[model samples]
Target: MWSTEDVARDAARRQGRGLSTAQVAEKVAEAARREQETRRQLDAPTETEIGPFATDPEHLAQLWAAKHTEWRRIAALLKTSGEQAYDPDRDAQGVTWAQERHARRQGALDRHAAWMRERQDARDELRTQIWLPADTSRRLRAIAARAGLQPEQVITQLADHVRMDEDGAVVVAPFTPHRVEGS
Candidate 1:
């Protein structure tokens, strides 16, 4: 995090050259401008058009697997090199840390899977409800307007509030109690 001014002052002191405050400031400004230009050049994209497969998922997965394999190979080499290495007893603490990290990842994956299933179920239910033989699409649209939501949103809400059992059947019932007749 050294600033351009710090670098310029250190340079002047090392050179045994006395620079006025204004001269030092000017030097720092010039260095900063050059650094900005260098960053801009580095960040500029290439003019050549890139192919879509440059970031394909299968390629990325292969790259990640190769990277991990190489890292493990390097670690094994370092262990065998007789260089001062970490004590196995001290590093045994890593097992608990790794287990905790793995458990967290499993929980996240499970939650994501459940969410995906719920979304798919909601979509199926929405399609069925909206396409019922007794009702037209316009009636479904009116219901959606009454609920202050898009038709899809209303359908998802209903599906989430209702779910089928493992026996491949759903029991339909009113979700909320109706007001008494005289109320």
Candidate 2:
């Protein structure tokens, strides 16, 4: 058996040169960050709306509490059902590795599915993506700061002039002025 650092060191040796220990750790951390970002991007909905729009804050908090309760219930179930509570290996026993991790992931997914069904009708918000050139983004940020507004707020105000449909397509007509209600 070998530690992760040992495996990383061996991998460095096979690459024809040894990387510094810090370099190896940095690489591992970078890989973890990339994986996390990938998961977030993949799970995120394509269209979303930011709120404080129509619903009452107290109602939103109650809904959030319900979701939290679901999570806690799921966690308790998972804790009870997961790998026998303790391990005999390595003498300093705790959670087992590998196979149990897969089990945990599957359990979480199942729980999430159930929770989603429970809260399906309670979902809110819409999301949209924006692409801007690097220089343009910098200018926009500066302008936003000057106006004491976030870049997104600035964009929201400007969006009022453009005629866009629910499908996010822009109408090829003359500009119009209107307040774009939050979804």
Candidate 3:
């Protein structure tokens, strides 16, 4: 992954210029300032102002279905492997092989849920009549994680830079672009 510095240096190198670490730090500081401003603009004074924190019915049903499917799959796996997976010695440590398998399966399910969340966010945007990819939301989440901030806290930090396409997009300008290989 290219850090902000890597990207700046890459751009400068392409333009036949030598970029310094101080320049990168300055740019990062500027970004931090911009993000702070955006966060202020995007702030919702109250939870009610934001509306609908829970998943919508359709997506909720999908999540339940997925959860059920995963539960059955993991049970079946356990049924088959529990014999080999469980060890009396590990049970003393409060970590049975069955528990290990369950953890692994649960981790996979969690990953799937994470991806599903991205899709669900995009769908929700569309339902509200916007066309932003969930990837933009993921970028928001990433920014929040990196900055030790809440998603809503920094959401509007770059709003001024957004350019909406025709048909009304959800959000503009992901912090990071998702590029497909071999366009």
Candidate 4:
């Protein structure tokens, strides 16, 4: 089999030149090293460039807002040039790389915003504070655990089973309290 060095040497011989196999090999190795360095530089993020903006979201937002006009101009240019939306597989570099990465991050941000709103809505209920004996608190927690619910949920369900009389003092109910061993 003709190895790469052998082929390179044969080509050099056919060209009637004084080039040696070691020289060809060295040039090829240098080219490979340069290409590797170029790729590394392209892929590595500059911490000094992104660190401050990444640490402060409000600052990042202000910067983005400030760039609105520039963004609009870029959008118009792209539109006029008939450039399509980013496709990760086809456009792995250049402007489209930023577009694809920002789109994915924005999607995640939107999902987190929705989840925060949901949690806020769920917590929009009457807030109350009451002191119970340590033993009572322990029993309440135990009951909640047995029913696979929060302590508040257990109280809410029990309250659901009760009705106040006209006097607002006498209450009739079907629930019977059960004793739980204290830990």
Global local distance difference test of model 4 = 0.51
Q: Which parts of model 4 are misplaced by more than 4 Å? A: 1-99, 131-154, 162-173, 176-183
Per-prediction TM-score to the true structure, in the order listed = 0.26, 0.23, 0.20, 0.27
Question: What does candidate 4 score on TM?
Answer: 0.27
Q: Say what the RMSD of model 1 is.
A: 18.6
Clashing pairs in 4: none
Better of 1 and 3 by lDDT: 1
Q: Rank the candidates by lDDT, best first.
A: 4, 2, 1, 3
Cα error, residue 131 of model 3, in Å, equals 40
**RMSD to the hidden true structure, all candidates:** 18.6, 25.9, 31.2, 19.4
lDDT of 4 by residue, 1-183 (tens): 333333333332333233233443444454455445544554663565655435443433333333332233333444454544312233223235345545766898999999999999889866688799999999999988876677877777677677888889857586643333441
User: What C-alpha lDDT do the candidate models reach, one value each?
Assistant: 0.48, 0.49, 0.46, 0.51
User: Could you give candidate 3's per-residue lDDT for residues 1-183 as a string of tens digits?
Assistant: 333333333332332223233443444454455445444544533343444674344433343343333333333443454433322232322234335555766888999999999998988662222355799878778877877666654644454457767878756665642322442
2 or 3, greater by TM-score:
2
Clashes of each: 0, 6, 3, 0
Where model 2 places Cα greater than 4 Å from the true spot, the runs are 1-125, 164-183
Residue 56 of model 3: what lDDT?
41
> What is candidate 2's lDDT per residue for 1-183, written digit by digit as tens?
433333332332343123333443444455455445544544663454546674443443443343333333323433454532222231121123333544766898999999998787556544689899999999888877876677887676666556878899986454322333552
The per-residue C-alpha lDDT of model 2 at residue 151 equals: 84
TM-score of 2: 0.23
Q: Which consecutive 10 residues in model 4 have the weakest lDDT in total?
A: 85-94
